[model samples]
Target: MRVTLKLATSLDGRIATGSGESKWITGEAARVEGHRLRAGHDAVMVGVETVLADDPELTVRLPRSDEIRQPLRVVLDSRLRTPATARLANPGTMILTAAEPRPVGTAEVERVEAPDGRPAPAPALEALARRGCASVLIEGGGQVAASFLGAGLVDRLEWFRAPILLGGDGRPCVAALALAKLADAPKFRRVSAEPVGDDLWERYDAIR
Candidate 1:
């Protein structure tokens, strides 16, 4: 599947404050553009920590249009910790977990092999591919972003950066890759950069 990692953060590449407040980091235009990006993808994904923290709907909220189809929502919940009452626990959402098969509200649950307790990116993508997902937009909370990028699965990046700064204590957009050398770092070639209201939207494609 074509994996696109999307990040909306502050100028310092921080997704949230030191205390975890992340609402309205970017302007309305950037968020609208984000929804458009989601509309273009076949599925949208996030790690379980994001669900537990933000409880986002993960659905496209564009203006009413018959052409708009909500993408399938996918969650990487290895331990099956996502509560059934979460906003995403409904039809059209799928939870890929490594835990024993069981019901999670009305959402579909699929068990995948994860030896490390966390579902690996490649196998998770395979599961989505089996479900006929041609493209996936990974809209994150750090660890998920790192996992995909570290696995060399991200095909494109759609990053939105606001003008404000959140400092070193703030939460980063991507968790550490634990690279031992600078040459081992995953590289991306800049595709485009443009302003979206008070935020800057940057696009890139994986160097590979």
Candidate 2:
């Protein structure tokens, strides 16, 4: 599957404030652009922490049109921490957990073995592929994005950087990775860059 990691961060690459406040990192145009990207994907995935913190309605909400398609919402909740009251528990949501399967309200549940006690992305991708999902857009908090990038699973990137700055105490766009040297980092080739309101929309292809 073609996986794209979409992120909106401050000028310093901080996605949220020190206390996790990230409601308006980017402007309305940037949000519309993000929804457009979501419409182009077959599925959208996020970690459970995001569901708990952001309570995002993952459905694509664009201008009323016959061509718009809402991608499947998938959550990687290893321990099945996604509560039944979670917004993503609504109908058509898919949850991949490492624990025993259980009915998650209207959401579909799938069990995937965790590699090294963490949710493994390969199994989730395989499952999505079997379900005929050719593309996936990963909208995450931090750790989830890092996991995909660390595993070399991300094929593309859509980054929206606002003009504001968030210092070191703020949350980063990507969480920590176990890189021993600079050469171990994931590289990407810049494909395009454009202005979206006061924010900058940047696109890149993973240099695998």
Candidate 3:
């Protein structure tokens, strides 16, 4: 499956403030573009941390209502940290967990678990494929995005950089890397950037 890491951040490369607070970091243009990008993907993925912090419904909202398409919501919570009341638990909910499957009603879902010792989240992606998802859009809070990059699972990155400077200790916009080695991933580069109000939408291609 094609995996795309999508996120919006301040110019200083902060996803949020020290208190883990972030709202309207990017302008509406980037937001709309993200929604449109979501419509073309099969599902949008994020970590349990994001669900806990933002409680986002993760639905695609196009500028024009007629352009909307509801994508499946996938959460990477190895320990099953998602709250029972989370909106993510309602629709095409997928939890990447390290726990036993639960009995549920009204949710078409699958669990993506990394074994005690193993490689590949492919099995999880395969499960999604069985459910008809051809691609994955990874929305992030930081760690989740880095994990995918570290695991070499991300194929693309769509980022929106806003003009504000949020210099806080919350986390770097990209937190997975230690920065000791610059060529770690060795296969990602910015390919495009466009003005979207005060923010810029940038696209990067990840080499395999």
Best by TM-score: 1
lDDT (Cα, tens digit) per residue for candidate 3, span 1-208: 9988898998888888898778878988888888888888998888778988888878887657565668888877666667778777775777766666673334444455576422135766777788789998988868777767777888998989999888767557666555567676447788998898889888999876
What candidate 2 gets wrong by more than 4 Å, as runs, is 65-67
Off by over 4 Å in 1: none
**Which parts of model 3 have CA positions greater than 4 angstroms off?**
63-67, 103-109, 116-120, 178-180
lDDT of 2 by residue, 1-208 (tens): 9999999999999989999899999999999999999899999999998998898888888779356777989999988889898889978688998888898778999998797655798988998998889999999969899999999999999999999999999999999988999999999999999999999999999997
For every model shown, the clashing-pair count is 0, 0, 0
What is the alpha-carbon lDDT for the whole of candidate 2? 0.91
Clashing pairs in 3: none
For each candidate, what TM-score against the reference? 0.98, 0.97, 0.88
Superpose all Cα atoms of candidate 3 onto the true structure and report the RMSD in Å to 1 decimal.
2.5
Q: Could you tell me the lDDT of residue 126 within candidate 1?
A: 93
